[model samples]
Target: MRSVLVLSALILAGFALSFAVSEYTLRLLNMAVIAAVAVIGLNFAFGYAGLISLGHSAFVGLGAYGLAILTTKADWSPWLAAIPAVAGTGLAAAALGYPLLRLKGHYLALATLGLNVSFSIVASNWIELTGGTNGIAQIPGLTLAGYKLDGEQTFLWFGLAVLALLGLAALAIHASRLGRAMMAVRDDETAAAMTGIDVTGVSVTAFVLSAIYAAIAGCLFAAHVHFVSPDDFNYAHSITFLSMLIVGGEGSVAGAIVGAALLTFLPEWLRVLGEGYLAFFGLMMLAILVFLPTGIAGLLRRWRRPALPPQDTAAGLDGAVSR
Candidate 1:
């Protein structure tokens, strides 16, 4: 199928680009993968269930801090630590998501935003627990069966593998009944409720799922940066994550990756734009919001869908690969 080929080609090019680029650029691409993972998770929250979450980075921070504390303080293996770190964050999200996700629209957004702020506060003040503002540093790299992923280039391969696996897993979720329920809920909560869908349960499920992804991303970020700090997962970073999901297209996996890659590499290209570049950055986001309301992934979907023949009766892609 054309879709499979397109995905395959993009993946091949991603790997090739990794090897072809400078260490510095590859480093940035690594960040793109990590951020993409987080934003992809966010897509489930805001993009799928119509529940806006502005505190996703808090979950990301929890994961990073969990791993950092385990590895640096307890001397746990980096790979092994990631499991508990991610699991703890997921469990926390599930517990909190029940109370938090009950809110909708701006209420949910504000509540989530407050959660992100609270996370920053704790991470900054809990010096002994989280190393305070200085943060936990010298986090170890992932070693698999005696193979160390230390070098930037070497790590790129590992990152690519994780991204690919997660992407496929997320795609599979899109084709399932849960995915359909998410779409139905997003389209109309009252209708969904009338049809026996547990609206609150569905919303919480999406939030928890998104949080798990963010936690994994946080683990990867901690490993990559070799450090974890309060500032790293601050509220600004939360907004950035949301921006990526929106700009990439709220409901598409490809959009999440594309948005991450674009945003990650944007600063490099903006070097030519001088000190005012960030000003341009804000403007660009606004432009995307104003003009391409559906985002890049949405645009691509429209383009691709139009290419399919009308009379053949091939079923349309349901809900844009949804949550």
Candidate 2:
């Protein structure tokens, strides 16, 4: 209940703020919301399931391309196209996850990274399908009841609604038995397996779930930008997604949202520092890492708790005597 309230408050705040901000800011917010969805998905794999996936961008690309190809080539509606695109992306993840999830740590990371590179190569070379380096343009925007969400402000609201529903779903999963199983695997796969948990299955589930979320984000990206390209979903974006999870708080839904918003807006906010902005940004990130190793969510958790009073040895002895 508390979690729901917190999430609702955050969503309400964002919705309210959207009206007060400039169009540019609203656009940024939309991007942040999209990124948040992907980051939250990453939290399932990297955070809960302890999977290091650099192939996340590839899944997003698959989704974007899937939607783009369906809507443009097949003349399918955006709403209808999204279902197969997202599902196909999840299926791809499930198919690849079995073999890839066996690798641990850097091995898994490298494998996923290679996957993203391969995806980029195909997207760039397959000119007939993905539009090559030029990308697919004039893709249709999303519509609701004959009203097109063509404006940034309107789109932000729609994105926010999507984010809210997905966020709640993620929170529900986090508190479920499966979520605990994933955490168990993360903490100790050997122990999890010994306790009757199917570690492999859990890993695959997490990967597939993450892919589905990425696909959703990709669909939204294509619809929002009306463009799909290889450059937009690359290895760098995968790294950025992981970075967002780390910066926000691994294994936390709120942390994912916070991290996405922070990283998305940080660059824009730092632009005021002139040419030295990037350097300062790096330093700021470093400071956060050094001081708040558990991320912003951890710091907030600590801040919310009341301090305990110091215990006296005499009182302890008295209590002991009474017992």
Candidate 3:
């Protein structure tokens, strides 16, 4: 019931913003929706399964390039291309996860970081395939019922719909047994193993799920911008995605969305500060980290806590006087 309300509110809010904002703002909103999708996926890996992956952007890049290559080179439809691109990325993650998941903490982080760098190197060097730094251009936009969704407002609506569906899916997973197992594994792998949970299987599942989400985001990016390049999905993007997950509230789906929106618009908002905008932004983020350690969602949750009723308060006061 709560999830339904939240999803409805999100959709309604997106519609409201579409009417309220400029085209550029709508485009930014679309990007936020896209980023939210990726960040929610990251929550599964980093927040639930406790995987420190710095290579998430690579999975996103794979999806984008996969779609780009298929649609451009193979003359396939965008819809048809997305299936192979997303599924293949998931498979790649599952395959890589078996070996990479063995490393823990910073070791895992570095391994994934190396993976992102390797992906960038290949994308940059493989001029014939990736178009090198120039990127794949003139890519086609997505169509629905023969109506091309090329406008920023139309794309924003489509992206919002996707984000809503995926967000609901994430919420469902968060309430399931698999979600609990992932959290348990995150808390303590040895304890989870002692309780008969397959730690490795859970980790790989989380990684694959995150990869699939990243793939969807990548596909959206390709369709929206009609371009694919290594620079767009670099290590910096992975770091930003991770930061979004953390800033939104590590384990919460709502947090992912909120964090994505906040970070997406923050720099733009700070630009009003001129030359010292970045410095102010950094300090503001630091304040958030220090004061709201659990992120925006955490702050909301705290605010939502029910207060004691007047009768209950009176009874407590009377009991204290009697004592």
Cα error, candidate 3, residue 82 (Å): 0.2
- Which of the numbered candidates is closest to the native, going by highest lDDT? 2
Quantify all predictions' global Cα lDDT against the true fold. 0.85, 0.91, 0.90
The regions of model 1 sitting more than 4 angstroms off are 1-6, 307-323
Pairs that collide in candidate 2 are none
Per-residue lDDT over 1-323 for candidate 2, one digit per residue giving the tens place of the 0 to 100 score? 76677788878988999889999999999999999999999999999999999888898899989999999999899999999999999999999999999899999999999999999999999999989999999888899999999899999999999999999999999999999999999999999999999999999999999999999999999999999989999999998898788889888888999999999998898787887976886776788778887788888877876453347666545544420
TM-scores of the candidates are: 0.92, 0.93, 0.92
lDDT of 3: 0.90
Question: Candidate 2 — what's its lDDT?
Answer: 0.91
Error of 3 at 283 (Å): 3.0
| Model 3 lDDT tens row, 1-323 | 67557667876898789999999999899989989899999999998999999999999999999999999999899999999999999999999999999999999999999999999999999999999999998778999999999999999989989998998899889889999999999999999999999999999999999999999999999999999889999999999898788788888888888888888988888787898976886786688789988887788777875454356465656555420
